[model samples]
Target: MGEAYKLDCDICAYTENIFVGFGLLYMRLESIASFVQDAALKRRIEEFIGNPSTRYDAYDALYVCPVCQAIRNELFIEMESDSSQYKISYACPRCASVMQQEHIENNVPVHLSCPACEKGKLKATFYMDWD
Candidate 1:
């Protein structure tokens, strides 16, 4: 895998997960430069295409934030969760509402649903910080 970058929206400060997600989708294509039939366009693709190890520079090539790219690709499915990062930053501003809900069922605490994901909950857990 190449370097992982967290791209934030300039306007909302929301990360453009979809843009990075779709870029990741296309990076799987071998010889991505081959898709363009036009020599001029093909040349341009090669000019800015990053090394396989440090891909994703393209996300910032044309826009300050990738969300402005306005992409709509069906291949944008199958996004991998950046769960490890989320584990550390669960109190993001967007989750403030979800963080306050708690209920007990059958003597077990059932965490409330996350507003952003609509399927997660807040839980306090400990881990050795490796970084």
Candidate 2:
């Protein structure tokens, strides 16, 4: 076992005692962020793609708005469309508008504050566990 730590959100007084283990909320983000080499990432992609047994329904990516910090992923592809086929585009689900190009990224920090928080918005966080 590793050391655990507390993550606190000052705005809403949100606090979580996080332990270093499996099934954590940010596992996906941590795993992706831990990737050190482009070649390793390429190899991982190749392993999934080059293998004839592999079956992917669709390739997905994520994007976020710098302004509102709203998340827009491949799911938002429907909400927005791009003429270029290069990158997965997104539309703000909350705003129902296209996110600016510069605001998009392949990946970003999942946790962020709501823009409306300062505008009197309340953000909620939830945690569940195995019984």
Candidate 3:
């Protein structure tokens, strides 16, 4: 037997329960720079950090649905009932367009919808999540 390990996410305050044994060695890796020593790992990490899926900073652009011509807000509220779910009900400050949030896999700036126009738009927004 080795030891038990725990991983904590600061943003969500979510902790992952992990058990480590001699058969399956467990290591606590920290920082992107330290994890990837090999060229391939470094490249992969760099690519992952650069990709929007791994990082939200790449998706900071505002989006507008052509069908409705409405500018959607990036700020969204998460549904407390479900940890994996979120909802965007803020009306567009510009066009007063009703906005709804939609989850698309593992990405940021979730999809937005307008009831009046029935347009599914996406934008980069911020939301507060506590666990």
Which candidate number maximizes TM-score? 2
lDDT (CA) per prediction: 0.28, 0.36, 0.34
For candidate 2, list the clashing residue pairs, or say none: none
TM-score of each predicted structure versus truth? 0.20, 0.28, 0.22
Window of ten residues with lowest summed lDDT in model 1: 83-92
Q: Can you list the residue pairs that collide in candidate 1?
A: none
Stretches off by above 4 angstroms in model 1 are: 1-25, 28-30, 50-131
Worst 10 residues of 2 by lDDT: 75-84
lDDT tens digits by residue: candidate 1, 1-131? 21223333323423322112224325532354555355754454454444343232212111111212221211111112223111101122422321221222222442333233333442322221211
Please write out the lDDT profile of model 3 over residues 1-131, one tens digit for every residue: 22233333323433332322221111211243253345644454444443333321111113344445454424222222211322224455566666443333223343444323443333322232211
- Candidate 2 Cα deviation (angstroms), residue 14: 6.7
At residue 80, candidate 1 shows an lDDT of 21
The stretch of ten residues in a row with the least summed lDDT in candidate 3 is 20-29
What is the Cα-based lDDT of residue 112 in candidate 3?
A: 45
Top candidate (lDDT): 2
